[model samples]
Target: MGASQSDNAHLSKADVVSRIKTRLASADIKKAQEVGGIFLFNIIKGTTVYSWTLDLNKVEVFEGEPEDDPDTTFTLNEHYFKQLVYGKEDARTIMQAGRCSVTGDIMRAMKLEPYIKLN
Candidate 1:
Protein backbone atom coordinates (compact mmCIF):
# COMPACT_ATOMS: atom_id res chain seq x y z
CA MET A 1 0.00 0.00 0.00
CA GLY A 2 2.90 2.30 0.82
CA ALA A 3 4.70 1.84 -2.47
CA SER A 4 1.81 3.29 -4.50
CA GLN A 5 1.42 6.43 -2.41
CA SER A 6 2.32 8.78 -5.23
CA ASP A 7 -0.03 7.00 -7.64
CA ASN A 8 -3.02 7.45 -5.38
CA ALA A 9 -1.96 10.79 -4.00
CA HIS A 10 -2.65 12.51 -7.34
CA LEU A 11 -5.88 10.63 -7.98
CA SER A 12 -8.74 12.92 -9.05
CA LYS A 13 -12.47 12.61 -8.65
CA ALA A 14 -12.91 12.05 -12.40
CA ASP A 15 -10.40 9.23 -12.38
CA VAL A 16 -12.11 7.54 -9.48
CA VAL A 17 -15.57 7.98 -11.00
CA SER A 18 -14.48 6.53 -14.32
CA ARG A 19 -12.90 3.59 -12.56
CA ILE A 20 -15.99 2.91 -10.50
CA LYS A 21 -18.22 3.07 -13.56
CA THR A 22 -16.00 0.69 -15.47
CA ARG A 23 -15.51 -1.67 -12.55
CA LEU A 24 -19.16 -1.82 -11.64
CA ALA A 25 -20.19 -2.29 -15.25
CA SER A 26 -17.83 -5.23 -15.62
CA ALA A 27 -18.46 -6.64 -12.17
CA ASP A 28 -20.07 -10.05 -11.80
CA ILE A 29 -23.68 -9.38 -10.83
CA LYS A 30 -24.15 -12.61 -8.88
CA LYS A 31 -21.49 -11.57 -6.39
CA ALA A 32 -22.31 -7.87 -6.37
CA GLN A 33 -25.92 -8.75 -5.71
CA GLU A 34 -24.89 -9.71 -2.20
CA VAL A 35 -24.45 -6.02 -1.38
CA GLY A 36 -27.87 -4.98 -2.62
CA GLY A 37 -29.02 -1.42 -2.05
CA ILE A 38 -29.08 1.96 -3.77
CA PHE A 39 -26.25 4.29 -2.82
CA LEU A 40 -26.13 7.89 -4.00
CA PHE A 41 -23.02 10.05 -4.08
CA ASN A 42 -23.01 13.84 -4.17
CA ILE A 43 -19.56 14.90 -5.29
CA ILE A 44 -18.81 18.57 -4.81
CA LYS A 45 -16.35 20.49 -6.94
CA GLY A 46 -16.19 24.21 -6.34
CA THR A 47 -19.66 25.52 -7.23
CA THR A 48 -20.68 22.36 -9.06
CA VAL A 49 -22.03 19.22 -7.47
CA TYR A 50 -22.34 16.02 -9.46
CA SER A 51 -24.52 13.18 -8.32
CA TRP A 52 -23.99 9.48 -8.93
CA THR A 53 -25.94 6.44 -8.01
CA LEU A 54 -24.81 2.88 -7.42
CA ASP A 55 -27.73 0.53 -7.58
CA LEU A 56 -26.31 -2.67 -6.20
CA ASN A 57 -29.71 -4.23 -6.51
CA LYS A 58 -29.44 -3.79 -10.26
CA VAL A 59 -25.70 -4.21 -10.28
CA GLU A 60 -25.19 -0.90 -12.04
CA VAL A 61 -23.59 2.49 -11.48
CA PHE A 62 -24.72 5.63 -13.21
CA GLU A 63 -24.56 9.42 -13.12
CA GLY A 64 -27.49 11.39 -11.67
CA GLU A 65 -29.50 10.32 -8.66
CA PRO A 66 -32.00 7.49 -8.56
CA GLU A 67 -35.70 8.03 -9.19
CA ASP A 68 -36.59 7.11 -5.64
CA ASP A 69 -34.81 7.66 -2.39
CA PRO A 70 -31.54 5.84 -2.06
CA ASP A 71 -30.83 3.47 0.80
CA THR A 72 -27.88 5.69 1.62
CA THR A 73 -26.61 9.06 0.38
CA PHE A 74 -23.01 10.24 0.80
CA THR A 75 -22.13 13.89 0.29
CA LEU A 76 -18.52 14.96 0.11
CA ASN A 77 -16.18 17.13 -1.91
CA GLU A 78 -14.25 15.89 -4.94
CA HIS A 79 -11.02 15.79 -3.00
CA TYR A 80 -12.43 13.70 -0.20
CA PHE A 81 -14.17 11.42 -2.71
CA LYS A 82 -10.91 10.72 -4.44
CA GLN A 83 -9.39 10.04 -1.06
CA LEU A 84 -12.19 7.66 -0.15
CA VAL A 85 -11.92 5.72 -3.39
CA TYR A 86 -8.19 5.29 -2.95
CA GLY A 87 -8.56 4.20 0.67
CA LYS A 88 -6.68 7.23 1.91
CA GLU A 89 -9.50 7.81 4.37
CA ASP A 90 -12.18 5.72 6.01
CA ALA A 91 -15.84 6.50 5.28
CA ARG A 92 -16.91 6.37 8.90
CA THR A 93 -14.02 8.47 10.05
CA ILE A 94 -14.75 11.11 7.41
CA MET A 95 -18.41 11.18 8.32
CA GLN A 96 -17.59 11.38 12.01
CA ALA A 97 -15.18 14.23 11.46
CA GLY A 98 -17.72 16.15 9.32
CA ARG A 99 -15.80 15.70 6.10
CA CYS A 100 -18.70 13.75 4.69
CA SER A 101 -22.43 13.85 5.22
CA VAL A 102 -24.48 10.67 5.21
CA THR A 103 -28.23 10.33 5.29
CA GLY A 104 -30.28 7.20 5.99
CA ASP A 105 -29.17 3.69 6.86
CA ILE A 106 -25.75 4.95 8.00
CA MET A 107 -24.56 1.52 9.17
CA ARG A 108 -25.11 0.09 5.72
CA ALA A 109 -22.82 2.80 4.37
CA MET A 110 -19.75 0.82 5.40
CA LYS A 111 -20.74 -1.89 2.93
CA LEU A 112 -20.06 0.64 0.16
CA GLU A 113 -16.30 0.59 0.77
CA PRO A 114 -15.74 -2.32 -1.57
CA TYR A 115 -17.82 -0.84 -4.34
CA ILE A 116 -15.94 2.43 -4.34
CA LYS A 117 -12.45 1.45 -3.31
CA LEU A 118 -9.82 1.48 -6.03
CA ASN A 119 -7.46 -1.44 -6.16
Candidate 2:
Protein backbone atom coordinates (compact mmCIF):
# COMPACT_ATOMS: atom_id res chain seq x y z
CA MET A 1 0.00 0.00 0.00
CA GLY A 2 1.11 3.53 -0.65
CA ALA A 3 1.95 5.75 2.26
CA SER A 4 -0.53 8.40 3.29
CA GLN A 5 0.26 12.03 2.47
CA SER A 6 1.70 12.57 5.95
CA ASP A 7 3.99 9.56 5.73
CA ASN A 8 5.63 10.88 2.60
CA ALA A 9 5.95 14.40 3.90
CA HIS A 10 9.00 16.36 2.77
CA LEU A 11 10.89 18.45 5.31
CA SER A 12 12.17 21.90 4.66
CA LYS A 13 15.74 22.71 5.71
CA ALA A 14 14.49 24.27 8.91
CA ASP A 15 12.31 21.28 9.60
CA VAL A 16 15.22 18.90 9.14
CA VAL A 17 17.40 20.92 11.52
CA SER A 18 14.67 21.07 14.12
CA ARG A 19 14.20 17.33 13.81
CA ILE A 20 17.91 16.81 14.50
CA LYS A 21 17.78 18.95 17.63
CA THR A 22 14.78 16.99 18.85
CA ARG A 23 16.62 13.73 18.31
CA LEU A 24 19.69 14.96 20.18
CA ALA A 25 17.60 15.94 23.16
CA SER A 26 16.89 12.25 23.65
CA ALA A 27 19.91 10.44 22.21
CA ASP A 28 23.48 10.74 23.41
CA ILE A 29 26.22 12.22 21.25
CA LYS A 30 27.89 8.83 21.11
CA LYS A 31 25.17 7.77 18.71
CA ALA A 32 26.69 10.30 16.37
CA GLN A 33 30.16 8.92 16.93
CA GLU A 34 28.93 5.80 15.22
CA VAL A 35 28.31 7.77 12.05
CA GLY A 36 31.52 9.84 12.40
CA GLY A 37 32.81 12.97 10.62
CA ILE A 38 31.38 16.46 10.34
CA PHE A 39 29.61 18.00 7.36
CA LEU A 40 28.37 21.41 6.38
CA PHE A 41 25.35 21.15 4.09
CA ASN A 42 24.64 24.06 1.82
CA ILE A 43 21.09 23.82 0.48
CA ILE A 44 20.28 26.16 -2.33
CA LYS A 45 16.74 27.03 -3.31
CA GLY A 46 16.93 29.19 -6.38
CA THR A 47 19.26 32.06 -5.41
CA THR A 48 18.54 31.53 -1.73
CA VAL A 49 21.20 29.50 -0.01
CA TYR A 50 21.30 28.47 3.65
CA SER A 51 23.82 26.37 5.49
CA TRP A 52 23.70 23.87 8.31
CA THR A 53 26.55 22.13 10.00
CA LEU A 54 26.27 18.51 11.13
CA ASP A 55 28.82 17.88 13.84
CA LEU A 56 28.80 14.26 14.91
CA ASN A 57 31.33 14.93 17.66
CA LYS A 58 28.72 17.10 19.32
CA VAL A 59 25.70 15.54 17.65
CA GLU A 60 24.44 18.96 16.78
CA VAL A 61 22.92 20.65 13.75
CA PHE A 62 22.84 24.39 13.66
CA GLU A 63 22.25 27.05 11.07
CA GLY A 64 25.04 29.25 9.64
CA GLU A 65 28.71 28.35 9.72
CA PRO A 66 30.70 25.95 11.83
CA GLU A 67 32.96 26.89 14.77
CA ASP A 68 35.88 25.36 12.91
CA ASP A 69 36.22 24.14 9.34
CA PRO A 70 34.04 21.12 8.58
CA ASP A 71 35.53 17.83 7.44
CA THR A 72 33.51 18.03 4.25
CA THR A 73 31.14 20.48 2.70
CA PHE A 74 28.22 19.41 0.53
CA THR A 75 26.40 21.77 -1.78
CA LEU A 76 23.09 20.68 -3.30
CA ASN A 77 19.80 22.25 -4.12
CA GLU A 78 16.82 21.84 -1.85
CA HIS A 79 15.37 19.06 -4.01
CA TYR A 80 18.48 16.89 -3.89
CA PHE A 81 18.84 17.62 -0.19
CA LYS A 82 15.41 16.17 0.52
CA GLN A 83 16.43 13.06 -1.34
CA LEU A 84 19.63 12.86 0.69
CA VAL A 85 17.87 13.10 4.04
CA TYR A 86 15.29 10.54 2.98
CA GLY A 87 18.01 8.02 2.11
CA LYS A 88 16.39 7.61 -1.30
CA GLU A 89 19.59 8.90 -2.91
CA ASP A 90 23.24 8.38 -2.25
CA ALA A 91 25.49 11.40 -1.89
CA ARG A 92 28.30 9.76 -3.81
CA THR A 93 25.99 8.93 -6.66
CA ILE A 94 24.58 12.42 -6.53
CA MET A 95 28.09 13.83 -6.88
CA GLN A 96 28.87 11.38 -9.69
CA ALA A 97 25.74 12.48 -11.53
CA GLY A 98 26.55 16.17 -10.89
CA ARG A 99 23.43 16.72 -8.81
CA CYS A 100 25.58 17.80 -5.89
CA SER A 101 29.11 18.96 -5.18
CA VAL A 102 31.44 18.02 -2.36
CA THR A 103 34.61 19.67 -1.12
CA GLY A 104 37.33 18.55 1.28
CA ASP A 105 37.71 14.83 1.94
CA ILE A 106 35.15 12.74 0.06
CA MET A 107 35.84 9.56 2.00
CA ARG A 108 35.05 11.46 5.18
CA ALA A 109 32.02 12.93 3.46
CA MET A 110 30.84 9.44 2.58
CA LYS A 111 30.73 8.74 6.31
CA LEU A 112 27.69 11.02 6.45
CA GLU A 113 25.17 8.66 4.81
CA PRO A 114 24.44 6.85 8.07
CA TYR A 115 23.87 10.16 9.78
CA ILE A 116 21.32 11.12 7.12
CA LYS A 117 19.57 7.81 7.80
CA LEU A 118 19.34 8.89 11.43
CA ASN A 119 17.06 11.61 10.21
Q: State the C-alpha lDDT per candidate.
A: 0.83, 0.75
lDDT of 1 by residue, 64-83 (tens): 89998899998999888887
For candidate 2, the TM-score is 0.80
Cα shift from native, residue 95, model 2 (Å): 1.0
Q: Please, what is the TM-score per model?
A: 0.85, 0.80
In lDDT terms, how accurate is model 2? 0.75
Compute the lDDT for candidate 1: 0.83
The best candidate by lDDT is: 1
Q: Largest TM-score belongs to which candidate?
A: 1
Looking at model 2, the pairs that clash are none
After superposition, candidate 1 runs with Cα above 4 Å error: 1-12
Q: What's the distance in Å from true for residue 93, model 2?
A: 1.4
Residue 102, candidate 1: alpha-carbon lDDT: 90
Clashes (backbone N, CA, C under 3 Å), per candidate, total 0, 0
What is candidate 1's CA lDDT for residue 16? 68
Local accuracy of candidate 2 as per-residue lDDT tens digits, 1-119: 24532453555688876766666556556756776667888999989999998888777778988988888898999888877776667777789999998888787777665456533
Clashes of 2: 0
Cα lDDT for residue 31, candidate 1: 69
